[model samples]
Target: MRIIISPAKKMRVDTDTLAWHDLPCMIDRAEVLYDKLASMSYDELKRLWKCNDAIAALNVERLHNSDLRIRLTPAILSYEGIQYQYMAPGVFTDEQLIYVQEHLRILSGLYGVVRPFDGVTPYRLEMQAKLPIEGAKDLYGFWGSAIADQLYQETDCIINLASKEYSVCVSRHQKPGTRFITCVFGEEKDGKVVEKGTLCKMARGEMVRYLAEANAKSPEAMKDFACLNYVFSPAHSDESTYVFLQKKSQDSEE
Candidate 1:
């Protein structure tokens, strides 16, 4: 089984510290996107990135100066989001790292799908970015079935931990006989499921860590995940969706 997750916008380049691995499988395709962004004027890029001056300037410099093939960090270590911060791949053991390398994939706007150990240079492009390619209206259109095809090649089953923006690419193009499962993390509140953004991120990260540590290799194995006070809610889950619910503080008190 493979677990898919979204790439984080908050990133850094740290080639000096980490050992570089092979470039992403679709690096040639990524080069096209990179060139398109590199060719845009500062104001146009700022608009495309939907960021302020500081971020725009830093990314522009990175695009102009960085060599994608020369220096890179592991894709798993590249992101610095709330989820990644909590998952903390940096501290994983060798066996855990191997398990993650084999089973975890990050869905990227720039790189399509990346393995945890894939070498990547930092740049900004979201899966939902509106930048139009020649024949495609948006990044999703350009990516099309390419990412899904790659995932299908890797594993027969996919445990989706990514947000919709990134997961859509895979969910839309599954070949017949493929198993796709989505994991939902939320809390019970007022007799409803409440998915707070930050807690969800933390739970997703923790869940990934749990799976890696346990070397979970099947859908049934993942059901055993009970990280950060979450418990698998069988009544709330189905074949396609697995829901893990945290008890509300008031409920915990009671």
Candidate 2:
């Protein structure tokens, strides 16, 4: 499991920097961090230890831990003000992998839980989930503020539907299986997330149906907030407008 990111043949700032891959490098550090995994412990092996909500317990700093020896060196990492961090697969275990996957779902507000057998995941767990496609980026600060006060507080829900005039935004670029998960909340009538293992699959015709049905009921989405208002690549474009995705891109990490 030893991982070493061989630097490419260019001045990556200093010709000495390369980001670590999570797999081999992570495996290399397995012996050292193995003890930190709950499942490796005597008392918690078989039990799913309900962890501290997603962001709170993340060991981001652990990436820079000493034994594994990760260094950014002098790489020209930022381009146009975008910063990137390297991930090495240090000490990754099956339990930790599962926990990390679930952690992503919780943060992204996607499915109720992460499932593998749905055919898109790396592992084969037969689960699926859905996401709320609200103004996702705008809600990040809100989520942060909510977490600052109290994490995962069950709160109110607001339903967002498309307007009637623009029923569907089709694209030749639109590939199948495009999906996302975003935070959703509402009163108990909208379905409270009391269980930790629910999957909501809104792909293919199901996704088309949901949006179409929603649009027929609400006009504001199609009329006021067409795809051009945001930043991500839109499904299509038209006169005086360009679309941007309000949800996570297809390239986003799970």
Candidate 1 residue runs with Cα over 4 Å from true position: 250-254
Q: Give TM per candidate.
A: 0.96, 0.18
Error of 2 at 195 (Å): 14
- Give the alpha carbon lDDT tens digit for every residue of 1-254 in model 1: 89999889888877665575688899999999998988899999999999999999999999899877877888988999988987889899989999988999999999998988889988899999999997999999999999999999988899998999999999999889989999889977788877888888898899899998888889878788877888999999998899999855676688
Best-matching candidate per lDDT = 1
Provide the lDDT at 57 for model 2.
Answer: 27
Weakest lDDT window of 10 consecutive positions for candidate 2: 118-127
Model 2 alpha-carbon drift over 4 Å, by segment:
1-43, 49-199, 203-254
Scored against the true structure, residue 69 in model 1 reaches a CA lDDT of: 82
Per-model root-mean-square deviation over C-alphas? 1.4, 20.0
